[model samples]
Structures are given as structure tokens and as C-alpha cells.
Target: SMAQDAINRVLVDRAREGKFVVRLKGGDPFLYGRGYEEAHACAEAGIPCTVVPGVSSALSVPALAGIPVSNRGMTHEVTIVSGHLPPGHPGSLVDWEALARMRGTLVVLMGVKNSPAIADSLMAGGRSPETPAAIIVDGSLDGQVTHRCTVGTMATTLTDRGVRPPAIVVVGEVAGLPQVLTRA
Candidate 1:
């Protein structure tokens, strides 16, 4: 990530000069898209910015791939988190231990690389090793691929399948609803 703050400043500076600047992003800009942050930057500089909402992949990705993030009474609650930071990182805001204990769905975005560490954290925090997990890659794209495994085999599945970034990792029973899980 090239100094995002710097880019925000550039956008503000250009807008200050009467230049029409645009920041186009995939998914919802307000939902972890930093649209709010950029808007704040503009407001601090007295520049005007507008935010348009888009369908969040968090709800759409799994849905498009035949995985329902929620069901009738099967899923009472859902917790979405960012896995960019592995568990135990000082900057990480996620409480993997608490999440492990939650009786709900856990959806992690941008966690392909840290899937191993994440798996360990969830398991260490009391999550079942047999908890169903799914990795939806290239979501909503022509090349989309869904990888299924249990929390115990998440790291191995990822490693063995050559899973890459731009993936959404679903850790919960809902993930296994599609079919029987394939062990790594």
C-alpha cells in the first residue's frame, strides 16, 4: 500500500485547485473502503466529497458462490472482521479468542496469507478444529474458486491448494452447509 495518507492529501490538494478528482473502488467504499476516511480528510481541508454505496462482498461473495452467510434460525448472529493483521499483533483489533467462543458466523476478509496463524488463534481460543471453513477466492469473478476444509485443515488446505490473496475466509458451520468438507 503506497502511503495512502499521501494519496489522500494529493486528492485534497487537487480538489483544492478546482480539479475534479475521483476515487473509484470496488465493493462498498464506506465499508472498509476508506471512503469515510477520505471524506474526513476532505472535510478537514474544507473540500467536498460524496460517497456512493455498493454491494459489500462480505454478504455477496459467499452468497454468489452458493454459501449463505446466514440462514433462518441456524445463524442468529454474524461477525465480520479483517484478518490483515494476524492474532497477537499489537495493532490488530480482532479478539480471535472471543470470536472463537462466539456461536455465530465469522467472516474474514483479506486473510489468505495469515490463514495459518488465524487458524491457530481460533483453535487455541477454544474453537473446534472440526469447525467448517471455506475460502472463496476471486470472488464474484469468472475464475472464482471455493476451497472447503475444517479449521484444523485451513492452513493445510490453503498451502496445498496454492490459495492466494483477494480471498474471503468463512469460519463457521454455515461454510460447510454447501457439502461435505474435503480434508487437506
Candidate 2:
């Protein structure tokens, strides 16, 4: 259903015919939403277009759970990454070593299935095993569950606890900062 070429063809045809069309997509239209590709197609076809932003899963989920990703003196940067690649993409496309070397907070979406591998790679690439990592399941929903642990133990912790998909994972120094988490 995520065939970009098919969607692009439709948008291009409509734009060429001077017809107005709303390309509705779930989640933030910009963030991993393929909005850029569609926009490019429309523009190249001489079509005028505008973008209306939608709530991204990254911020919305944390907010609903009362976790403010950014807190003064705690964290100022957050990185959001896609856990799954486009169909047919190589399994090891992520540069785990570079990501590990980064200093800001990290947020990974659609990454439940690959969480174990990701954790292993990050640690192998030099990220601290003690680095705090959290897996948030059904984030923002009534059944939301947040499993917090260090990066070293995350893979085992998640497996032992049986946490599953439709989830997001966060890792960084900020994740360890106690002040930002909701006091339960």
C-alpha cells in the first residue's frame, strides 16, 4: 500500500490536468510521510500545492504520556529515526556507529522488531551500555507501556518482559535524567 511510484503517478496526472487533490496521509505529512516525494512530483508537473501539518507520532505519544521530550538543562535536542526501511532496503542501512557517537537524544519509530539488533549495534559501536533506553508501546493509547532500562540490558529486558510493537524507542543521556519523566 506504500507504493510511492503509484502515488506519484496519480499525483502527477492530477497536477497535469490542473485538478485539485488532497493527498491525505497518516501521521506527520513531512516526517517519513513521503510528503517530499509527492510535493516534488506536483511541483515538477507545474502544480501549485500547499502542505498542512499533522501531529507526528514522536511528540504526540510522549505528550499524552506526560513526558516532555525537551526540558531546560536536561535535553535540548531530539532525533527521530525510522526503524523500518522501505521495502527491499538492505537490513543494515543504519549507521549505528555514527548514531552512537551523536550526543543528543534519540527516538526511533516502528523499531520494535529490530530493537534487539539496534541495541546490540549501538553498544558495539561505542554507546554506553548504561545509557538509558526506553521502549514505549502503543504510545499515547490507553494501554501505553514504557519500559525503561539501560541500552546494554534493553534487548534482554524487552524480551523478558514481552513488550511488542506499534511502539517507539528512545535513547540518550536525557532518557536517564529523572526530572523529565512523569512522577508516578
Candidate 3:
């Protein structure tokens, strides 16, 4: 729970010794990177810090699977959420109902464990049951698996297939584009 705090202390001590510190984080620092915590700690200790962003699994994974999240006349807006945590966790504290109700695309990173639960919640909150859904595992890596199904069947289908973590689950019309074009 104090991972960032520990990192901050190290950075602060290093800075006090007149050394410059570079903290590298996975994915966009501002987007659930928890960089803010470290930054704040460094600032309070009179240590200067800069934030650098990395490609996140949210967009990169789908792209590697040949799925464009947003296409002209297809989807204009895209929302990235996390499936790694439960609905109450800070990581998964998204308004699933509102997101499900949006007209744009939905990309869920690290959501394999909770994808089924998430799908159920969205459907219960009025998202279309027929909405296309996909689980992309090990995105942008050598071993990538894409599981295509519908929101209605996401829970059961994903469970039946034993989909795991380190995957991105996409929901909405954009997900159907690849499935239809490739017949996957």
C-alpha cells in the first residue's frame, strides 16, 4: 500500500544528497500511475521531479490486436478503465453505468479477473446486452490472445475460457469491428 511512499523516501534522500532522480513508471503517470503521491512527497522534501508517460496497456493492447479503438464514423470517444480491482477499489472506481451508457468506446486494462463482473454490472445498469466485448491477453507482446464475445455472454464465456490477468477487455461497437472484419 505504501509502495509510492517508499519510492518517495528514496528519491527524497537521493535529492538531498544533491543528486537528480528519475522515477520511471509503467503507463501514463497521471493515469493511475500513482506518480502524484511520489511527486508530492518529493516536493515537500524540496526535491524536484518530472513525470514521464509510457504507453499503457489500455490503448496499446487493442492496437496490437489490430483493433482501432476510435474510427471515423465508428467511434469518436474512448474511455479507459481498469478491471484489476473491484468496483470499490481506487483503480476500478469508475462509473460503470455512465460509461456503459456512453456512445463511445470502452477500454479496460488489467481487467481479466473482473471482466465478467464488470459486464454483469454494466448490463444490469442498462448497457446493451448485445454490446460487443473482447478480452486481449498479453497485448503488444509475442503471445497475445483475443477472446471475442458479447456483453451478455462475457461473464460465462470468459470464465469458460479461463481468461486471466494482464489483459485488456474492450467493450462497445468498436470491439465488433475487428470481429466482423476478421470473422474472429
Best by TM-score: 1
Residue-level lDDT for 166 in candidate 3 = 75
Report RMSD (Å) for each prediction in the order shown.
Answer: 3.6, 3.6, 3.2
Model 3: lDDT equals 0.79
**Top lDDT hit:** 1
Error in Å for residue 132 of model 2: 1.5
Ranking by lDDT: 1, 3, 2
Task: Please give the clash total of every predicted structure, in order.
Answer: 0, 0, 1
Candidate 1 Cα errors over 4 Å, as ranges: 179-184
Per-residue lDDT tens digits for candidate 2, residues 1-184, read 7589899889888767777788998778899888988888888877888988899988777665555667687777887888775222476466777888876777888888878788887777788999987777887667888777888988898889898888888888656655344524
User: Global lDDT for candidate 2?
Assistant: 0.78
Candidate 1 residue lDDT tens string, 1-184: 6577998899899998899998888989887788888889999999988888888889889887778888887788889899999999999999999999987899998888998999999999999999999999998888888998999999999989999989999989899895543323
Window of ten residues with lowest summed lDDT in model 2: 85-94
Per-candidate TM equals 0.92, 0.79, 0.86
**Evaluation by lDDT, superior candidate among 1 and 2:** 1
